[model samples]
Target: MATDPVCKMNVEPAKAAAKVDYNGQLYYFCSESCHKAFTEAPQKYAGAAPPPHSSHQHGHR
Candidate 1:
């Protein structure tokens, strides 16, 4: 399984919607949107740290 850099979604390499090779590393995307986003700015996400997981509650009534 690979994490989609753009949205941090878990994706299966074989079943990925799209894949791209960047800087000698292969990246997989859950959707074309993510693929497009990553290709547009690979550097922005390639070296970016994954967003920390949090359980903050959303405001709801």
Candidate 2:
């Protein structure tokens, strides 16, 4: 399972809605919206460390 960098949803690479190769790493997305968002600003999500638990909620809101 791979985490969709845009939405943080778990996705099976084989069943991913879209996938992209960036900086030698592969990223999977659950939907085209996510894929488009990532493509537009990969540096915003790519290689970005997951937020700490305490601040995680802030992102969702």
User: Number of the top candidate by lDDT?
Assistant: 2
Angstrom error of the Cα, residue 49, model 1: value is 3.9
TM-score on alpha carbons, each prediction = 0.78, 0.78
> What C-alpha lDDT do the candidate models reach, one value each?
0.87, 0.90
Q: What is the lDDT of residue 45 in candidate 1?
A: 89
Q: Which stretches of candidate 2 lie over 4 Å from their true place?
A: 50-61
Q: What stretches of model 1 exceed 4 Å from their correct place?
A: 50-61
Candidate 1 lDDT over residue span 1-61, tens digit each? 8999999999999999999999778999999999999999999988786334422445444
How many clashes would you count in candidate 2? 0
RMSD to native, candidate 1: 8.3
Residue pairs with backbone atoms closer than 3 Å in model 1 (clashes): none
Clashes found in each candidate (C-alpha, N, C closer than 3 A): 0, 0
